[model samples]
Target: MSTLSADLAHQPGPETVAEGLLTMLAVVPVCLLVAGYGRGVQELWARRGAGQIVPPWRVAAFGVGVLTVLAAEQGPAHELAESSFAGHMTQHMLFLLVAGPLLAAGGAGLPLTLAAPVPLRRLLARWRVTPAVRRLRRPTTYALLAGGGQSIVLWFWHLPEPYTAAVDHPVTHTAEHLCFLAAAWSFWAPVLGPPRHRAPAPVAVLALVGTMLPASALGAVLTLAPAPVYPARVFGADPLADQQLAGLLMWAPMDLVVLVVTLTVFLRWLRQLDRDRPAGLPRTATLPGTAAVPASAATEGERR
Candidate 1:
């Protein structure tokens, strides 16, 4: 026991202690979410049996999302982000594209609902039908609000004035991350979240495509700039090169991520359409050696 204690315990400096505390703070929300989800899963398992509430893939996606957030906010990535424009862009992309969508698709909303107290759940149900809530829930309203919100947040934070402030200050930096994550989550929820909260696939597609325009434009501006926009945050000896690389990172990877997600949503929508179709309602039939029979002809034959 003494040997174990000695081996396990070591003196940590102030910087190490602060980093540990910040890491712990980052972990708190994830832990709370997991706990709530676990409780909900337990109840669901009792009522509906195992693996019926949330799909395995969704659970895996949530885990990956959590990992992505930790990686972006906590260790080497965070360190790199402090000094490098490209690294910061990489972290932001992970938050926006990977973590946000994956978490939304993980279907945690229902689980969290299930985890809430009965009184709170009842309150939420009542609130759901309120005018303000209904308006916010509208597909078009949410799509526009979400996309617009994310675009504004992204552009504002990337501006040299605000970006420099964020880099220089801890509180501003924290706020920047929160803004990015919240905007991203809002932008994706209607497309990827619980089915009850989701919007039509067409609407989601349009929202995503619209968002891409501004994002790509920003990236293009950075890539084509004559000099470094963020001189203090440059990592490499060639600041211009670093900024250009950062811009390219945002351009290519973000666009690819959006395209992939759009395709996934479209295909899933197609699948849902096929699934909801009436069974055994054939409009035409063809025998091995015969031409297809039209529905009208078949109906006429039946009438005769």
Candidate 2:
């Protein structure tokens, strides 16, 4: 045990004690910001006579999720950063999949939009209706940015030196997280809807599922591999277990979120279609003799 302690001491930068302090500094502010901003929005909306339409519980959950992530990455959880690949995976998963979705679900984006100054909101509204926004509104663009970008960042950061180096450098570490969060937000944008841009439900669903595949495969591969893929262990502590945990976190929970979001988008679309259909039209099929039936229908029926 003494020797193990000595080795852990020699392993890299500061001791866990100092790292924990730094971690708190980073995470606490983020949690407070999210929570405070959410509250402010609710207050603002209430003043406008919107009531408590935005679910306070969801906002609270989102703030909690962010806090949970911060705690995991910084506090007692800082050991995970130094420990194994699996631990790192857990951190990434929580940040990207769990916390990210909760934040988005809390209506953070829209509320922030609402919270902006009236002039800014007007500008945003105008921009939203513009041709440029229309082009970007496509589900394909959201999928590519959210799913494809995330996959790329995940794989790129896993490269041995870079991964280790990121932990040592604050900027890179922050950037890594920002990438994950951004990707998650983009991927989920379509499902949650009211996007500055919009797309058909089917298309958004396809994009969500399609983007998830590569990330899932990557996680599976990492989880099953016997040896650690990163060299951080050479100078640091155990890497194998951390890597595995990271993989599992990436694969399971993230996939589940994707599935849930996809179903949500699909169900919402179906409901919209139901609402939009002409009042008298049958829900299941078009009128028999309408243009939908085709011009050759009568001749075919007479011949029969």
Candidate 3:
């Protein structure tokens, strides 16, 4: 029979254990923030309208955010962080896909804004009314920040040194999480359209589908590569296995979710447009001036 000492020897060492604990410590504040903000927003929305309740999507989003943070801090996330390229990939997917959309749908930003002190809130509101803030509030800016920024971070950070550097430095690690969250928010913003930064329905749908391409391509490249791209290989395990798993995690489900949401938003927008069209006019002529007689008597007579 194998001795207890041999079994203990096979387990992960003290340094790895300490690293995992630190990772959990890092994740706590973000989780608390999400929970507190989510609860506050739900309550605020509930109070604003009679007989209306928090939507299921909002609840799901909040759950996703909390769970993702928990996973990152406690469960497979710690192992993945310490393990191979695949673990890191999986972490990215959770951050981008699971936590990203949920936080967006949950209106975490608005709540965070509301949670600020009164003076800060006043300042923010004032700033938001300014030209610069108005311009930044455009759908294009939201889409880029949520979609393009995420893709850029995902691709840029995969290079060898930066990935390792992130692991070695706590600040960079936090920044990495922030980037993921921001990108996820950006990706989801078009789909859910948070209050201050809503996009046109069509543009929102397009942005959602367009953003997933980069992650898919990157995943495929990593999956097929003959050699590892990241330098800090895991010591006591199979690096390639972790890499393949991470690639699949990053590529497959995230794209699927994006596609499904895009279809849903497109159909919903089409239905809304159809419902709003006037009864007598051709759908194509529903534009304001085209559908109505001009105020001028001469123009009205000419139409008749």
Candidate 4:
């Protein structure tokens, strides 16, 4: 405790809160622009009686995701993250695991594309089927790029040198966050995004579980390690405690999120299977301990 207190006492003063506030200023305008543009597109398409280009619920979902991001990035957490490892972890988890998924689930891609100008739209349409995109659209690619990539990035930046550098250098920190967010969005595509290119629920489920492995391992290692790897000495808390908190933050929340949503995915999977089944196939219960048998087989049973 004394060692921790001593470290805290030597801390430097914070930059003006205005720095965080300035970021908030940027976030608000961008969110408004997105929402307004989406609404405008929806209205334009609706007026033509051509149906909506972007659904209202999706825009609302996207707005929610954006607002959640702003709260994580520009709120006190952003400032505290600079000083406290736990705070930093909270921000990262919120952005990469929570808000990013919400944004993807909202299918912001559709609205953003629809909102683009005609020239850009034509370019995008041409690019949609390009070989590079087709390759990236593969389910295995989503698992590798999003699930594997995010895990690697999360672990890589937490290494002692990288952690120290990000804490010490603003640009490095920004890059770290951008990398995290990008990887996270990529990872979530199978589950939430590029809706037209959805991976099978089973595959998406496996990817989600596989993605949890590295992050959980890293968290466990950090939680059990003898010393802190982060540059938390100048911060106002015990580095050891802070590191443990950060580890727990990394370990539990994402897995819980996956667990809850995987259940939803499973139910959806069952429903999807039911829909895709041949017309007379017997439906299976989504819950365990139920078997599906052919209705015709049952109907013609002669005790055989």
- Which segments of model 4 are wrong by more than 4 Å? 1-53, 278-304
Per-residue lDDT over 102-157 for candidate 4, one digit per residue giving the tens place of the 0 to 100 score: 77766666556767778998999898799998788687676667777888898899
| Worst ten in a row by lDDT for model 3 | 281-290
lDDT of 1 by residue, 1-304 (tens): 9988787676676656765776677689888888898787677777888778787777788778878888889868888887778888888898888888888778887778899999999999999899999999897789878988999998999999898887766667777888888898889888888676777898888889888889999999899999888755545667888899999988898789889888998999899898887887677856689899977787888899
For model 3, residues 51-91, the per-residue Cα lDDT tens digits are 23445566667777777767864687757666666666667
Q: Candidates ranked by lDDT, best first?
A: 1, 4, 3, 2
lDDT by residue for model 2 over 1-304, one digit each (tens)? 9999999878766544565566677767785667566756677667765535456665665677677666656655546655556655666777777666666656566667765678988999999899988767666676556666767777788777778777776667766777777676666655553454455677777777876787788888878989877675523354666667677878888688788878888888899988887787643324657555443665567699
Model 1 TM-score, 2 decimals: 0.81
Task: Name the TM-score of candidate 4.
Answer: 0.77
Cand. 3 TM to true fold: 0.76
Better of 1 and 2 by TM-score: 1
Query: lDDT per model, in order?
Result: 0.83, 0.68, 0.71, 0.74
Local distance difference test, candidate 4: 0.74
For model 1, what is the alpha-carbon lDDT of residue 240? 89
Considering TM-score, where higher is better, how would the candidates rank from best to worst? 1, 4, 3, 2
lDDT of 1 at 126: 100
lDDT of 1 at 172: 72
Better of 2 and 3 by lDDT: 3
Colliding residue pairs in candidate 1? none
* Candidate with the greatest TM-score versus the true structure: 1
Residue 178: error of model 3 in Å? 2.7
Better of 1 and 3 by TM-score: 1
